[model samples]
Target: MTPLPTTERRPLSDRTFGFLLTLPALVLFGAIVFYPLVGSLTTSLFEQSLVQPGREFVGLDNFRAVLDDQFWPVLWNTLVFTGLGTIAPFLIGFALALALNTRLPGRALLRGAFLFPWVIPGVVVSFAWLWIFNANYGLLNGILFRLGLIAEPVSWLGDPDTAMYAVIVAKTWASFPWIMVMLLAGLQTVPGVLHEAAGMDGAGVLRRFWHVTLPHLRGIIGIVILLEIIWNFQHFDTIYVLTGGGPAGATTTFAVAVYDTAFKGFDLGRAGALGALWLVLLLVLVVVYVRFAEREEQS
Candidate 1:
C-alpha cells in the first residue's frame, strides 16, 4: 500500500491522541460502573451471605426468591413513592415557577428562601419532619391545637395509613426546589414575543400559556420528569431516617429494601439480586425516556 502523506497521518495521530485522552475516563467507568455491575450479577447468581464462608452458585434461585417473597409489596410501594414524589414536586414547582416568572415584589428573596429545603441534607430534613410529625409536642399539632382543628395531637408517622404520606410530603418539600429551578429556567427561555403575539390575537393568559409557554417548556419538563423518576426511585436516606420502612413497611422503597438486605439482613445474594433488578428497571426507564424525548423533539 502507498504510504499516506504526513499531513493525513497527523490528522490520524490527533484522533488517536484524543481517544487516548479519553482512555482514563473509560477505565474509571469500567472500574466504577462495570466492575460493580458484573460483581453484582455474579453475586445474584449465588446463595451468599455475609456470614458464609463461600458463595454457592444457585442459578436463578436468588431472583426467584426475591420475586416470590414479600418484595412485590415493596416494589409497589417504590412505584407509589416514585410516582407521587415526582408528580407532587413537578406540579408544585411548576406552579411556583409560573407565579414567580412574573414581575413581583420580593420575588428574588422568595425564590432564594424557597430553595432552603432543597439545600438542606436529606437526614436533616427527615429529622425536621419527624419533629413536626410527633404525636405530641410537635409544631403541627401545636398549631392545630391552637386553631381548634383537632382536640388532640395526631400521630402522623405512627399510623401505617399516614406514614407513607408523611414521608411523601417531606420528600416533596426537599425535591420541589430542583423542579422550581428547572422550570424557572424553562420559563425564561419561553419567548416573551410569542406570549405578546398570542395576547394580541385575543388569547387569554391561560390560552397563551397553553399555546406558547407549554410547548416551549416541553423539552425541559420531560428532562425534569425523567430525572425525578430516577432520583425518587433511588431515594433512601429520607425514608430511612423518617420511617425506617415503618410504621410497618409502609414506606419501604426498593432502595430501602436493598439496604436492609445487604446490611441488616446480611443476605449478600438477595441484596445483589435486588440491586440488579433496580438497575434493570432504571435502564428501562432511561431507554423509554430517551425514546419519548426523541419523539417529542421530532414533533
Candidate 2:
C-alpha cells in the first residue's frame, strides 16, 4: 500500500494577522466615532429640533445662517483661545523641562508634582480656577489687592476683556505638564556628547540650546504644539465652567457655541452646521499633524 501524503498548513501573513488583531478596534471606532460623525453630517442638512418630532430638509441654509450669525466672532475667539492656549503652555512646559532635566534634588518627586494639574479631572480643574478667579475673596484678587496691584478685587471671569484670558490661564495650567513630560523625555534622548562638544567649542548655554538642543527637539516640539492646538480647539469644559461663554459672548469658542446652539437654543440643525465647520477645521489640523508625524518617522 502507498503511504498517504499530508498537506502543510500555511501561517497567516504578518499584515493579515495584524489586521485581524486590530479588527475589533476598527469596528469599535466605526461604531462610536464614524457613526456619530455621519449622523451629525446628515443632521446638518436638515432643520431639526431636539424637542420637536418633525424634520425638514434645509440643504445649506443652516450653514449660511451660521455664517451670517456670530460665526466670525466665534471663529475669532476660537483662534485666539487655540493660539494662546498652545503657546502659553508650550513655553512654560519647555522652560520647566529644561530646568528639570538637570541633576537636581527631588527631581523625581518634582516631576510627579508637576503632573498633578494634567492628571486632575477637567471639571475639577475648572471649578478650582473658577474660585481662583472669583470676583470676591478669590485667591488671585486677594493676592493682587495685598500686593497693591489693584485697589479692589477684580472680577476676572466677569469682564469681557479678561474672561477669555482667565480661561486660557486655566487651560495653560492644565496643559503644561503634558508638554513638560514629552519635552523632558525628548531632552533625555539628546546626546550628551553633543552638549559637551558644543561647550568645548565656547558655545554658551543659550547657544547650545538654540543650535543643538533645539534641533534635536524640533520634531517633538512641532508635534506637541499641533496636538495642543487640536485639543484647545475642542476644549469646552474649562471655558464653560469658568466663563459660561462670557460676559458678552467674548469667550464663545466653537465648542461652547455648538453646545449652546444645540442644548440651550434647541436648534439641532444649526448646532450640527456649526459642528460640521468645527470638524472641518479639526480635520485640517489632524491631516497636517499626520503628515508631519509620518515625515518625522521617515527622516
Best by TM-score: 2
In candidate 2, what are the lDDT values of residues 1-299, reduced to their tens digit? 34334335536655566679988999999999999889988888999998999899999999999999968999999999999999999999999999999999999899999999999999999999998988987999998899999998888889999999999999999999999999999999999999999999999999999999999999999999999999999999999988889788999999999999999999999999999999999999999999999999999
Please give, for residues 75-149, the per-residue lDDT of candidate 1 as tens digits: 899999999999999999999999999998999999999999999888999999999989978998899999999
lDDT of 2: 0.93
| Backbone clash tally (model 2) | 0
**Candidate 2: minimum summed lDDT over ten consecutive residues — where?**
1-10
lDDT of 1: 0.90
lDDT for each of the candidates? 0.90, 0.93
- CA lDDT of 64 in candidate 2? 99
- Superposed by TM-score, candidate 2 places the C-alpha of residue 161 at a distance from the truth, in angstroms, of 0.5
